[model samples]
Target: MSEQGQNRTMVEVHRVPPTPKASRSRMWTDLYSEHVDRAATSLGDAEHCPAITIAQLGSVAMIRLDLAAGTIQRTAEQIGYVAEPTYAFLLQVSGTASFSHYGQDSVLAPGDFTLCNNAVPYVYASDGPADLLMIRAGAGTIREHLPSPEQFCGRHLRADEGLSESAAQLCLGVCEQLASGLPEAVHNRVARNLLDAIATAFAISFDGLITASAVLTGRHARVRLFIEENLRDPDLSPGLIATRLKLSSRYLRMIFASGDETASAYVLRRRLEECARQMADPASAHLTITDIAFGWGFNSAPHFARSFRERFGQAPRVYRREKLGVGMPLRAVGAEAG
Candidate 1:
């Protein structure tokens, strides 16, 4: 971090390139624990440690993290050390990852970006070594003009598309400028511009679908959150949700109608995505395809297989094999043959 004034300091924290493996891992872990949280673990190989370089720009922070193939998660129980909630907008510079939060999951590639809530539990697992640019800011900065920010959490927004591209570019530029040193007034201006760019990116894409008035969008956000929180319930339905939320079924449907998918479709899609995510995880490998399906609210094996194929464009077992980079199991082959 470089400092201009007393409060305005640009501090950069990174691992010393030549450090031994164990010490490097410990250093990276300690750094993240201090700045980010203690929940961060080295996802690299047994001897390898992921490296992160963070630059703090007053209220907004930028980080360039290089993570090896593995997983990192922040649980709800870890919220105490997190202080106030902030919005972490991650821009995938290279590599692929499955980002999960708010009952939504997305596979992000280079030039793709997403929002993560610091107040909630979230997981980011890399398929391989990955580089990411994360801009952290107050939630209000991005949420002020963006309608239903929850809807976009963990949802991939293309950096090459519309205002999102501009925002990503702006972030990179701001970081570059700050790194080279700038006046305090210029730093503040750049920070404000970065926030505005983020707001523009979100509003241009999402706000166009709703109103500036927060009532309808706020209700929609709550509804989406409820759906995400209850996605595992097999009996989850718009009617059930409406009853629980003390709203009429018709109004619930109307609220979701403002967006793309219907309530039922959205629920099913999320369930399918979640099941797919679990199927991709090695930890869940002990669970059979049937168990995984049933665990995520799919009652009928055939129905689950059908919907899984429809949503993912392949059989669940096939998708699992692709994710694990292995051939089909003998049992799967026998089932297919039978």
Candidate 2:
């Protein structure tokens, strides 16, 4: 896609207000079935219920089904109504739901989880009053990182086994956290990491069912190691770091923010410490102060000296002289003043 096309394809979610009764009636008559079909197709399931109320809170889609002591069953034939690719991360908050897909069938109680993809066809039913959280993201966004999007098209992934439990918990936590009003800066910083965590957790739970290798563990580990190794790189901003790591700069910021630090702050701290170490080293007694400062990636001598004093409670030259010995041979100050 062209950059403009890609930008247009990006998911930009807006907070939806609680559904009023009149609005609910109109939604049910006009949009509900179509909405359900879209959701079902993306998750590879046909969901049947008498009445379901949906609420939008930020990016989360919350649905409450009033089965009212009755039961509803959906068949694969009904699932064929859905046409688009999508993911359905369902969290059962109340009542019970029975799901059958991908040659597996299970009953989900409150607090349980079931994952669905709309790339294929499947079935689902519910009894009594049930509240569910359905997390949906564009198929394009998901498939970009998944290894086998086709295999996941029409399946229900149960979270009762393996890594699904952790993934389910993470999904719930993220939804709840997003629902709770987060500051704009912090929200942007944490959103993608939370999404990646949930996606990875889901992939692990489903084993190879979802085929999302890019969201797995190795990528995160490599990025972290890269950061640690290049701690002294002066140009190590989030965008540059992410480009080197082949990840979105937004995702990089989210990762660092999750660690309770901004990307720039993290790089700055690392560089500062590297300079401090070199300044405190005894072997560099022959080199002028500017050379020592510049060697550790400091671009400005005044800035480096000021930052050094603030961090170590002494000027860079004085700290170096005191720690590495002031009486050492003095190499002439050179033009390389960092």
Candidate 3:
């Protein structure tokens, strides 16, 4: 597909619709089915409707729900809606709410978070108007990075506490970043980091440490996040990142080795991708190629040109013109001249 076509496809995926009104007289009945499709049940006035916004990244989905006073339930039969077990990490963004799971119930004020396991059954209730951020992921995936996630399930982690607060903030931040729409490669790494953040948050809240495997997984995610945040620093290196994150240099290399590339290789790949994005963007048209290179941490012009071509199959200038709709026809002119 053409670049324009690709962009249109992305817009459709990241679209967040406004509050939808129900015209049907059986709006509440319709909501019952909707909540069922989402693996839940609702009890509220028929007039009350829900405002839901969804932002998806890979297997992780972030759902923002503005709901009226009601109770939502997940029954054993509803588990059939999904093939695999899944977990919903709910962050109560506003108003008062309560959660029940595994024979335990907890209340949450604004800023609190709790987990609801869909592998079994659970319930979430709100006293009045409620705003919630829900991060839903495959149960196996969460357990891969957070062994014993069952303990955290249905337990309220108050946001006022230190680690709990950090967890809430991280969930919000992850949703915001994912909603911005990122390239697929970068999106995968960021999604991993978000999962790690959630696992670590649970670990901290329980006054426990992540297992060895979980540590390695979490460290990789954290390092990826650090690299992305510091792409502008020309001095970004595994050693520098290890120092900043208080990890051993060899360990950092080992973490990235599990992927297709080494640490330095991954960094270079990301830098190249970032530079390409800038080149394709019309907003950066006024900047010189060399300036853009240096801005994304490429110190040497010749090195940047060579790497950019090696990765993208074209020179920076040509790619920019083709992408920004300026010099695409020049290729034919150049052929005629030849």
Output the number of the TM-score-best candidate.
Answer: 1
Model 1, poorest ten-residue lDDT window?
Answer: 329-338
Q: Give the winner by lDDT: 1 or 3.
A: 1
Q: Candidate 1, residue 231: CA error in Å?
A: 2.2
lDDT of 1 by residue, 230-330 (tens): 66689998889999999998888888776688988988887887787767766566667778777777788888888888888888877888776676454
Per-candidate TM-score against the hidden true structure: 0.73, 0.40, 0.52
- The global C-alpha lDDT for each of the candidates, from Candidate 1 onward, is 0.71, 0.51, 0.66
Most accurate candidate by lDDT: 1
Q: Which lDDT tens digits does candidate 2 get at residues 1-338?
A: 11111212222222212365444333433333454552221111123223544434334344444432322323333445445556665666677776643333567776566555543333455545556666555555455444444344323455565555676576566545444534444543354554465566556655743343445333543554455545546666678778898888777665554356676765566566655544554434567777766665667888877776777787766666666675665552222332
Off by over 4 Å in 2: 1-31, 38-84, 150-160, 183-191, 208-338
Q: Residue-pair clashes per candidate, as listed?
A: 4, 13, 0
By lDDT: ranked, best first: 1, 3, 2
lDDT of 3 by residue, 41-150 (tens): 34344445555566666677777777777666554455544577678788898889877665446898878878766655566768687888888888777777777565
lDDT for 23 in candidate 3 is 42
Q: How accurate is candidate 2 locally (lDDT)?
A: 0.51
